[model samples]
Target: MSAPERIPPRGVTTDEPLAGLLTHGELTVRGRIREASNAALYCTVAHEGREAACVYKPVAGERPLWDFPDGNLARREVAAYEVSEATGWGLVPPTVLREGPYGEGMVQLWIEVTTEGDTAELLALVDGEEPEPGWKAIGFADVGDDRTALLVHADDERLRRLAVLDAVINNADRKGGHLLPTAEGRLYGIDHGVTFNTENKLRTLLWGWAGEPLTPEALEVLKGLQDALGAEGALAGRLSALITGAELDATRARVAVLLETGRHPEPSGEWPAIPWPPV
Candidate 1:
């Protein structure tokens, strides 16, 4: 069957019933998303006359990672969604774990977005030593040859919230291509398979706000997550099922440190701060 004509829910942005559409629906693989490193199937999920587009990445098709344990990326994707919902940021697209044609894997509602650049509308590679007024500098990038370009991201609140989310999840890869900005103005982040590690693996293109104080709104959300991810806390209970106990504790500790610092984190200098093939 062809992919669904209509898009599905945007994770926590919509009502709860849409999750039902993704969770229990019949999934049909229509095509393969070739750009993804793993086997990402473009599919349509339908249930009780409700149908929407989604992506299914089976565990069997996943490439083994040296750092992360094999066969657990699906759960981490769902865990990322859970944390996104917890923050009330709705950064991740709605995701769930279920059995698919290739075996159990992660299924996420496919978010329809505008045709922008290689990444989202929030990032730009401009020729300058400093970012303009509306943009925040993310350091310089070696474009090619011997020339370098100044990398800057828009000074937007949504991206800031996602930066915080990345820190909380310890997201190892937040490339420009991972950003999804809809025509309607809402932004979503995807490809969370390499997240929630126990180590400080936060790497991304959204480092424009580094060392800046967290927004008041962001601090309030983090305050809520601190409680939700505590021992015996509701978020912690759910995460325990998806990630290892050590990873969960690491997640909690990351949140605590963010709250204590009250600012965006600076790079540790021990690890490569930016991802390769950045976009």
Candidate 2:
């Protein structure tokens, strides 16, 4: 059977179901993986001969301690990915919120496991163990040999553009595991729950060319992204409303800074490492 034309949800952006495509049944939760911050069982789901995976976040509706308010992190994640799709960068894959038996969470396309091994093995390669030539691995690590050209080729234009955005947003969780290199030589970035705000949480290892001028191609991409993001004021406004007043103002400051300077300032120890528990 042919797949239905996928359409993003309208009106209330939060918790928009994936239409009749998903049925009310036990979603086989294989590979129940867990991340550092959120307490959820991530697993792969299959349907109509197509397979995808999602982070099964169990929400008990309890308020948790964190920077951003509780009961809104998942929603922000959905919105961010949706806006990323609109940006036309393909930085983040398409995602939608689904109603699970436990609690409502997001369901995004499972990144095709193309890399040969886990992030640890990839880091081992960075440690001079070298996982063959031309293989790319990604995760959260400092900006050193762990992120050298082996995992990400120096000439990969797409990743270079993504690095710019990562710098601007002050992404804190750019570990080696969050990067996925496809067989077609394209790289996909993931785990963007902390961005858009302006708390100076910037921490990444892709600053090999810091203070250097963006390539003409990369500059064009960034300018185009800013324009596209401007048109979709609805997306940004929604995200801003979810965060605090200071955070919103900070996000605006960051946006302006990115537009003007086009270079991320050095990292600062202002905000905490993680957003909060139950994230």
Candidate 3:
């Protein structure tokens, strides 16, 4: 598949001004993105001479999950974005639920990241001993010939914020491919259809900072989320429209635990701690 087009700077392409356009705009499917298990299509959204590239996930295309109810994955995607925005992290790209050709679904502004070659280069090691600076090793694999390959991720603040976000939301799928780094040096996460489950199912590839103490800034963000999830808060009202009451309560409880402990969580060992195909 061809790479997605590079997105313009946020200053020139803010999602707020185009919110109405994205919700009510005319959608034309450009092509299908086969990498996703669901029916995800690349489409152009146009209204009143303005246009933007967006990924459309029709509800009919969602695969039924044994845990999560069917037909709600699209809403879950939008809920994740809502949480990200509420925290002021901007970790998730702007997403909304709207009508499309197939049916009602979630549509998110497309974010372009560095090419696969660039990602490979970032994860490559030099001298087989030290990784490129600003990267930290998390795991290793035996590549035969007595050689061991190290798994590492960028030592970036944005990624750290995302780690906390995942913890608060109970994200069940955070594959390495979900972490997209744009040319503008910003990191955005995608594919959040399996999040906010009442059961603790936080599978992810972001365990590099596991067991570390949460920074003061991260704690403040958690505090903000806790407040937003209060009974009378707007965020709580928004989430109620998407997920069950028990699930929303579980989300609040997770944030409360994080605030009380002020530490990144350790794997529970009850389930696989990491996603399949870490990268």
| Among all candidates shown, the one with the greatest TM-score | 1
Q: Can you list the residue pairs that collide in candidate 2?
A: 138-176, 138-177, 139-175, 139-176, 139-177, 140-174, 140-175, 140-176, 143-205
TM of each candidate vs. truth: 0.94, 0.64, 0.89
lDDT of 2 by residue, 1-279 (tens): 766343322211232243223333236666555444564566655454443454554444323637544335555455556555544566665555677656776555555645552333323324443434533333233447656333332335565666676764456665556766665544566766655544577655444445656666655655665554453555456555444556545554565666577553444546543222201
Error of 3 at 115 (Å): 4.6
lDDT of 3 by residue, 1-279 (tens): 444343353312245656776788889999999988899999988776667788999999988999986338999998998899888878888788998999999998887665632455334433365556787665665667998787777777887899899998899988777877777776788999999898999997677778889999999988989999999988999998888898899999999999998898988989988787666
Q: After superposition, how far is residue 21 of candidate 3 from its true place, in Å?
A: 1.9
lDDT (C-alpha) at residue 236 in model 3:
95
The TM-score measured for candidate 3 stands at 0.89
In candidate 1, which residue ranges exceed 4 Å CA deviation?
1-14, 116-120
Q: Of the candidates numbered 2 and 3, which has the greater TM-score value?
A: 3
Tens-place lDDT per residue, model 1, 75-176, is 999999999998887889889899988999999988877574224358888998999898988889888999999998999888889999999999999988
For every candidate structure, what is the RMSD over all alpha carbons to the true structure, in angstroms? 2.4, 7.4, 4.1
Model 3 alpha-carbon miss at residue 60, Å: 0.1
How many pairs of residues in model 1 come into backbone collision?
0
